[model samples]
Target chain A: MSSALVYALTGAALFVLGMAGLILQPHLLRKILAFNIMGSGIFLMLVGVAQRAGTPDPVPQAMVLTGIVVAIAATALALALARQLLDMNGEMRLPEEKTGKDRLDV
Target chain B: MRTLLNVTVLFLASAFGLALGWLILDLPVAAVRLPEQVTAQLEMSGVVHPVTAVLLNFRGYDTLLEIAVLLLALLGILALPRHVSDHQHRPSSANPVLQTLTRVLAPLMLLVAGYVLWAGAHRPGGAFQAGAVLAGAGVLLHLAGLLPAWATPGRTLRAGLAVGLLVFIAVAVALMAQGTLLQYPLSWAGALILMIEASLTLSLGLILAGLYLVLTDSGVQK
Candidate 1:
């Protein structure tokens, strides 16, 4: 209803969407992108709540700022690992994919 | 069976989403819980921007560790084995449009980065934003084939990568010697913050661009 609530709801929806993607996507890179989307959802929620009082909270804002940088660092590391995997196998699927352990059919 | 998993995922996601929507709707909207504390110490923190004060003054140790993490990521990227194709080290060709855009935009990005770094004391910009901008400029020049053949040249690159962490540690050690850790002298907080931020911006930009360069270099087809 309120703009803050709207944004927060949208963030929650994004988190769910990302999580679903993470679970469903078979490609390693897609999983990483889904993880990022999930992270962005959490960030959006933080920023949204900070504005709930009609004025922003600077502490959460600073934390979100730090979170963004840390997210990039982690993403870069993940990407490097993914690239290494691709080099080794010439394909982007996880090892678990071959093992069928990634499947939830059980 | 395939349809069953999809249905399960959608149903579970929707349930969780509903719970979150309820939580958001119920949380008190008018509570100015944290800003009061920030405002009380605003004058003493030496920055008009409360976020900067929190980041560089009150919670500086967090930032120090953050820089360390970034450096660690660069180190990790550097440690990865290079493929044989990587040895070619040829610059990717850029079209005339990209070359001209890089020429015009790179300088402007640098200027904007400096402005953002300086403005953090009183505004929304800070070292993080400035550093990202600087990294963006590097990526642009890199894409345009204007950067050096090697993304990093030996010791200078290593030193630049580690300088921000070193400076941050130096400041903390200096403070610890005076019976405090990461506690900048109140009178010199602004100057100290600016000095630290300048070093951090350089290292972060280098680390980010280095990461990108490594990602591109490992013979991965872009």
Candidate 2:
């Protein structure tokens, strides 16, 4: 019922959703988005915990800020890798096992 | 097998989610967030905003490494094969209204970025927010045809991109003579922090804009 509790639960849900997306999705971009979602969930949890004292604590908030920046940097790097994979194979996902596809076809 | 994997992952995720819910429900909302010493030492941090103080003063080393990480990402992107890095962008001309809006708003964003940089001393604004605004301006200019599709970052741009890290390292090293790393003389803490933030703002803007431009291209420009 409290705002902090609400945010904390939202963060938990987001983490679960993001993890599900990461595990189930095949597309590289979707994986990246899911990873970012997980990062956001962690950040949200940090901020939520920081806010438990009614006034937010500065240290955790500052850590979250640093984390957000780092997450963006990692996302940029991951995206570039995705683009490279696309250029080489013309597919975002690796060859599907169901198709019995091999590296040559990929 | 794939369906089984999916089901297992789902089950695990749900279990984790339940644990988190229970943790949240039991969390103590009332506690002393900061110790007496941390609150007592706040004045020497040279910023009234506690978050800013923690970021720039107490945990500055983390920020320095973070900027380095950003630069590493830029390097990684640039290191990609030429085919991937070199791509065509959108057409030179955009809708007239959009172009007009960009032209009107970009400069205002720059001004706002400056204000954010200055206001970080006392409020919520800081280098990251200001840098993001500047990046927004660059993206706008890119959309408006001010930045050409084939535009390679010039020397000044490259230098600007690295200036923040260089400044941070240099200052940190210089301060080693006085005492601890990144420890500004208490009297000079505010000014040094501002200088570092200013350089960081410029570099972060260019680095982000570079990534945006590279990733958003639609066609081969050359």
TM-scores, one per candidate: 0.91, 0.90
DockQ of each: 0.60, 0.57
In candidate 1, list every pair of residues with a backbone clash.
Answer: none
Judged by DockQ cut-offs, the docking class of candidate 1 is medium
Number of the predicted model whose DockQ against the real structure is largest? 1
TM-score of 2: 0.90
Q: Candidate 1: where is the Cα deviation over 4 Å?
A: A99-106, B28-32, B84-94, B149-153, B218-222
After superposition of all CA atoms, the RMSD between model 1 and the true structure is 3.4
What does candidate 1's lDDT look like per residue over A14-68, in tens digits?
9999999888777888888899999988988888877876777888889888988
How close to the true structure is residue B41 of candidate 1, measured as C-alpha lDDT? Answer: 90
Kindly list the per-residue Cα lDDT of model 2 for residues B102-162, writing each as its tens digit: 8899989999999999999999999999999998898888887766532355688889989
> Per-residue alpha-carbon lDDT of model 2 for A1-106, expressed as tens digits?
6586678788889998899888777777888999999989888887886675466677888899989888988898898788778888878875652353333221
lDDT of 1 at B157: 80
